[model samples]
Target: ITYRLVKEYNLMINILRAEVVANKAGELIMDIEGSEQDIAEAIDFTAHEGIEFRILKSGITLDEERCVHCGACTSVCPSGALTLRRDDWSLVFAPEKCFACELCVKSCPVRAIVAVMHLNGTVLAG
Candidate 1:
């Protein structure tokens, strides 16, 4: 599928996260870049092959008032979207770098991090 997306649709895919489910199912969150027509065609092609996908704008909200900044969330963040400032030990968030993997949300001891990513008005995470 990756090869076909690259060669046939001329799309560049950057995988952000991947996981295997309880059975044989698998999930992959990726960033796909291509022209509008090519992207549409690629989606159609993949859908016909039984692949499910959603194009979403991703982000998270950090409850600054409730945060303890114990560096727990920062340690679990795979994308470096969550970090502790060296000067003050405060948590710094780079929303643009986040892929909404929900690791920080799960790791936040005070439950300060909440994923804000949605699709069709439905929350996908958090």
Candidate 2:
């Protein structure tokens, strides 16, 4: 499917994270970029092939009230979605780049970062 998307549809894919259980199923977190028509067609093709494609608006939420600005989550964030501001040393979250990996959730001592799965504007269990 990835091969077809690149060769046939001429789309660019950047894989963020992937988890595959042998002979069972796999999940991929990626960023795909291309022309609008090609992208739409690719999505249609994926759906036809029984692939569940979800567009995530937000993957993780940061509670400013609970957060202590310790920046411990930054060490485990693979996508740089969680970072500390240089000027004031405050924590920042970029939800668009997050892949819902849940590393920050476990790393946070203050339980400031919470993982969320959003599909079509609906929040689902992570």
lDDT of 1 by residue, 12-121 (tens): 99888888687687988777889999999998998999988677666789999999989998888899988899999999998888877788888888888887777756
| Candidate number with greatest TM-score | 2
- In model 2, the runs with Cα more than 4 Å from the true position are 1-3, 11-37, 46-58
- State each model's CA lDDT, in order: 0.85, 0.87
Clashes of 2: 0
Q: Over the stretch 27-122, how does candidate 2's per-residue lDDT look in tens digits?
A: 987778799899889989999999888875447788999999999999999999999999999999987888767899999999988888776788
Error of 2 at 52 (Å): 7.0
Worst 10 residues of 1 by lDDT: 117-126
